[model samples]
Structures are given as structure tokens and as C-alpha cells.
Target chain A: MNMKLETIETDVLVIGAGPAGSTAAKHAAMGGAEVLLVDKKSEIGTPKRCAEGVSKNGLEKLGIKPSHRWIAAEMDRVRLVSPSGIDVWLNQENVHLPETGYNLERKVFDKHMAMDAARAGSQIMVKTLAKELTLKDDYVLVKAESMGNHIEIKSKIVIGADGPESRVGRWAGLKSTSKPKNMESGVQFEMVGVELEDTRAVEFYFGSVAPGGYAWIFPKGDDIANVGLGIINSMTSKNAYHHLLDFVRECKATQKAVSVEFNVGGIPVGGPLNEFVTDNVMLVGDAAGQVNPLTGGGIISGMQAGLIAGEVAANAINEGNCSLENLKEYETRWVEENSLSFQKYLKAKEYLLSLSNEELDSIARAFQGSDFERIGPMELLGKLVKVSPKAMVKLGKIF
Target chain B: MIISEFCMYCGECAGVCPRNLIEVGENTLKFGQKPCKNCQICIQVCPVSALEVEG
Candidate 1:
């Protein structure tokens, strides 16, 4: 195999131009680092795999203005339906900033984020795939393919913000493999031309309908919605797409389905990877398993981690130290900020997954007549702890 | 080349393309034959079926 070696230099190199990668590039460039962001795809967010629901707090932290072209609708409430079809409605008062849900146009949102990184002076290379990572004397070498040519870029630090199936993390020598039981395969569909009254509310169906996972209905607008469902592979050997199709049929949403777009993906339900960094390399976003185990959301946590990783990388480079010890600061920042929430959510998911359909129905029924304030996370966790003291004890160890 | 049913109308392919060869419409995301430079990055990263080169 005859391959050409072309060497370029940068202060920081970020792999994958997704939410996390772009955010890292933006922050690194803002910190005055010569950052290069690369993605294998020609476009930034074309495939539309995410559910596109971000909490208001998450958006605020990123300082992003919710664009009219990007927002499908604002959600203020959530309904959790049990196995027996008993619905428990939680109003805005119960959830944190319920009135500020974002139904994002992921393609536009992701592209705009990359543009922000570019505006911050980060160079973005589209259609460039990072094939492998190699460590030389003191720099991390990024071997990539761009337009049938082999390109090599050297940087003092490399950040892996790739998705769940991240090769960059693995190439960087991090144990990034997710167990089958820890991963949930998900499928989502964008449905247009459907009339629904609760345009500002997102709905979730739990228990038997989703087994270890849940089904969601996030409204985009008056008649457009993103209907999706996730199921842990360990629960049943059924493909996520088939299960999602069955749920769609059961809900009778398929009857009026005019135009539907499908996305088949996976979520790492595990809390987080054991290690997020090594010498001169840090993994952020789904690549580091930074997703919320309960809601399967990663945009907020991913971006947050990206910011920390970027800062840590730049600092380490400036100090002439890129060892694992220096990179441990990124790990410390992430754990101090979001590890507790992730652990709590993971415990909640485990307990919820262990319940029988009848138990789930009972829990849903118990909350059916109750107000939203009565079903907060603390209250829900307290109830679960009461039921399963052993599980609660395990969660206590992490806290 | 024809756009597939998987297109989500994200308008991303057009934004990233150097040649401005792709256009997303109301119902469908389409690609024009404005000579795509045969850059297959769009095909590699397209989450849905918005763009593809003719066989």
C-alpha cells in the first residue's frame, strides 16, 4: 500500500464536526488556539438522527439564540403513559424550565454551530475522515483522507467528539466499547401533515410499549412531529425500527402519515465511559458516553464536556505538558459538574428497567391523579429507593 | 441522481457543497447536475437520502 504523507500543523485538532466537536473547536479557537475541525461528511447535520430536544438551560449555557427556522415548537409539558395506557401528565411547574423546550432543526442547528466555530477562527474541513491517530515524539498525528488524498495533520492535542460508534476514541487507545446491555437501539421518524392539539407538549410512552426504553412524541409545529422510540437490545431481540413501526401502527399515527423520514441509531445508556482522557487525547460527547441515561440526551452534556476538554487541551499545550495527569483535569471538571446527575439517571433507568409491566402500570396509575409537582425527579427517586433499597444503596456509593 | 424518501430537508448538503449543486425543496431534497466534482463526502455524511451520484 503506497500512501502519501502530508504533514500540516495545528495547536488543536478536533475530530467529528457534530455538536460536541463544533463546540470544542469554537471554544478552543476562542481561546486563541489554531484549531482544525474535521468531519467525514460533506454536510454538517444532514442525516437528522437526533430527537432534537434540548432543555432551555442547555441552550442558555451555549448562548445560542433559538432561531425561528430551527425551532419546530416549544414544549411546556410532558405526559408519561404507562403500559396499561394510563397517562400521567406533568405540567410546566413540575419540570425544570418546562416552557422552554427546543425542537431543533438538527441540520441547520449543527451547521450553524460549526459556522460559529469558524467565526471563532477555527478551520473546518468537510468530507475529511480521520482514519487513524499516531503519536510521534511530542505531537499527536491525525491521519485523514480528503478527496482521495491522504492528509496528515500534527497537533499538540486531539479531541474526540465523535458519536457513540466512535473510532477516534478507540484509535486513541481509550476503552470506548459499549456493552450490548448498556446500549439501546433507537429509531425515529419525522411525521408531517398530522393534526394534533397539544403542539407545545412532548409525550412519552413507557412500560411495555418501549420495554427497557420509551417512546416519545416531540411536536415540531401544529401538524409536524418527531415520533420515535428506543428499546434496549437485551430486553428483546427485535430491531429498533420494527419496534418503532409497531408503536406507530398501534398509535394509529401511520394512518395519516403523509411524509415520514426514518432514523435508526443507538444510545449508550451506560452512565459514562470509565476514562475520558489519556495522554494528549480527550474524548467528549457520545464518544465518551456523556449521554443522559434516562432521557438519552447528549447535546447539553456533550457541549459542556467539549468546552472543558478544549480548555484543558489548550492549557496543557501552553504548559508544555500533555500527559495523562494534565488531561485528568478535564475528567475532574466533568465529574464535578455532571457525574452526579448521570449516576442518578443511570440508577433510575436500571430500576425502571427491572420493573414488570404491572409494576410500571401501578407507578403510572399512582401518579395519574396526582399533580405534576408530586412527580419530580427527587420524589420519583425517593419512591424507587423505598421500593428497592439495595439499588438505592448502590446509587449512594456514587453520590 | 434522484433523492430518496429518506431526505429530511435539512438543507445541509447544499450548505456544505462547494459547487452549490444541491437544492432542497418543500417536499423533496434534490441534487442538480451542475457537475458535483464527484466529491463523495455528501454521500458519506448524508444521514438521509438527499443526495447521491448517478451510477
Candidate 2:
């Protein structure tokens, strides 16, 4: 690692090099802004925090084509497991869903995305941690440390693409705190000896295994999978790791599985922040709480917001105005694009959190042997309402 | 706040801190100079229960 003291200036500065930051940097550079993107980690992505599942449609939306280099597995089926071990399966032919796509090798995928940003003329820096932000009238001064070397970056706009533990939002004085109930504590293990009922399917287990959230087995190969779970800490004293261990121990499919890697992180399940822009600073991705409240999935959404923020920042810089009023466009556009679905998901999440183990099993029972190919979402909900009216009361109104 | 050796520097604590008083490096977790209100939100969110109140 080269530790060099430096001072640089750019039209846009992006913090974090995850999916959101990389996409923001790529799009901003493509928009003709002189962009600089930085990540605190020595590598762009490692110790993977996600289940690495993404849809073909999500990549299509971002104009990204699937490459075998970063694709671990192609999935056509999604299995939802009940507390009592009943499984309800859905496939692409049965229902159009975003989750029926492919499992990604995020380590390779993230770096490739960053490489796209570099190809678009964005300067990239790894092992660079942004320490402080100084707000100025026209530009923000960023004090960063790169491998023990102090560096300064002055930019017309700063995009906060940092992950869940985002400091950028806080530094900019945004109301960025997620309530304990709204945050999901997640733990995952890359297990090599896992047995899968369907090698091409991704499985989700719901009930006591994970309170508020659910457990998942995202297969990376025929025999290896990223088995994980996320649970709301406020709902239980057991913590996420224990819940994951319990799930693994209890599941028949993972009896022979041994963990080769352990990963842990937090997911913000709150809807997007009320505001993600302040003067020249705009927040994207998890920093802006742009994750799906129900699924705890943010990669696609984050990248979408990143593209928007990149373009908006570039336009604001081109117009020589990086004011709060100018950056407000980003928030407005993002909300317009996501608010409806996000709100619905938030309500569904609340409903899901209220379910008991029995309620979960009953709901799964309702779907057992049902022809998924002919069942619409409304029919599914109707079944849910029949099986668990008490829990469905809240969910009914959301639909 | 005390971060135990069990900590993996995953930043779950920092994200849940209402005061934004924790910073996570690659292999480090440090409380900011600002006084922690002892909200204990960090402790609750820790996956391995790695964070605790200072004695």
C-alpha cells in the first residue's frame, strides 16, 4: 500500500466504494463530472455482508449484463420455509419476481463496478477513510487518511454512499438514526458442506429462527451456500449469531455444513430517510436508508439511487450551484421513484414482525400444494387472510 | 463503552448509535471524543454482544 500525503480537488467526491458509491462514481464521471471515489477498506469488497442474491431485472435496469466472472449461481426458484418446516416454492414461470436471478460473487462484482467507474474517468482510492467533513459555502473540504497518510479533498459535491453505519449523514447533520426496531442485525456463514434441497433455489426460513427478519440460504455453488439470518435486536435477547447457529443446528438441510467464513453486519430496515440532501452533500444507498424495509435488500436500489445522485450532482456542478435547493432534486426524484413500494413494504414488515410461530406455519400451510403458476398476489393474500386473519388484518390494508 | 475482543469491526454498533459517537476502522472500533450518553443501543445491536457499558 502506498501511503502518500496529497491534496486533490474534484467536482464530485463519493465516499465508500460499495455498489452505491461505485455506481455513483461511474455515472458521475460518465456525466462529465470530475469524480473521486474512495473506500476505507484495503479491498473494495470482502468479508461479504450480503447473501449475494440479485435479480436479472435489477441488472438490466442498470444496464449491467451478467458476467460469469462474478456470478456464483443462477437461481430460478425461491423457497419460503415455515416454522414447522413446510415449504412454499415459487419460480419465474409461476410469478414475476425480482429475487429470481443469480447469486453474485460480490467481491468480484464490486471491484468490477468500481473498475467501470475508473474507466469512466473517476479517480479511485482504496484504503482511504474520510475522517471529517467541513461544510463550506460552495464546496466541502474532506480530511481523509489513506494508509496512514493524511489527504485532503475539496469538492463541489459529496455523495454519501457509505453503508448502514454511515457517518456521512451524521456529519452533514441529517436525521440518520434508525430506531432499534428498524435495524436488523445480520450474521452469515459461508458453509461448504451444505446440502440443498434444490441447488438452483434460494431459501428463506421464517419464524422463531429469526425474529422480525428471516433466515436465508443463498447457494454459491452446488454444495456451498451463504447461510444467514437477520433479526431485530429489540425483539430478542439471543442476538443474531445465536439465532443463526440455532437455525443451522435445527435445519435438516445444513446438518453437514461447516462454516468456512463468518460475516456480520447491520441492515437499515427503515424506509428512506426523510431527507438525504444538505447543501452540497447528498446521501445515497444505506447512508440514506434506501434499503427495502421488508426484504432488507438494498444492492439494486442503492445502485439505482447512486446513478441518480451521480447525475444530479454532475448537473448541479455543471450549473455552478451545489446549494441545498439544487440538491433537493435528488431527494425529490428518488422519493417519486421509490416511495409507493417502499411504504407498502414498510407496512408489510410491521405486519411480519407481529406474526407468531404458529401464525407463520398456518400461512405457509395455506400455500401448500397451491398452484403457484395460476395464483396471483391477490390470491396469495386472500389465502394469507384466511389462514391468519389476525396477522393479515394489518397486511390486508397495505395491499 | 467497551468493545470486547469478540468484536469483528463490523460497524453494527456504529450504525445504530444515535449519537454517531463510534468509528469503525478495518480492525478497530473507537468511541469518538464526544461523551457517550450510555444509550446502550450499540450493545443491543451487536450480533456477538461484543459491546458493553464501561465499568
lDDT of 2 by residue, A209-245 (tens): 8988999999998799999999998788798999988
All candidates: CA RMSD (Å): 8.6, 2.0
Taking the tens digit of each residue's C-alpha lDDT, what string does model 1 give over A1-399? 766577889988998888999989998888778899987677888776688898877878777777887777888877777777788776665666422478788899899989999999999988786766887767898878776688999998899876765656666777876665566666788998755547787888887787679988888887888888878655765656667777887874446766567765567778788898988789999888898998888888998888888788778867888889998999999989988877778886777777777777777766667765656556665665665555466555543
Instruction: Please list the C-alpha lDDT of all candidates, in the order they appear.
Output: 0.75, 0.88
In terms of TM-score, the best-performing candidate is 2
Model 1 stretches astray by more than 4 angstroms: A1-4, A97-100, A195-197, A252-254, A374-399, B1-55
With candidate 2 superimposed using the best TM-score fit, by how many Å does residue A13's alpha carbon deviate from the native? 0.6
| Position A361, candidate 1: lDDT | 79
Docking class of 2: high
Residue pairs clashing, model 1: A47-B47, A72-A220
TM-score between candidate 1 and the true structure: 0.82
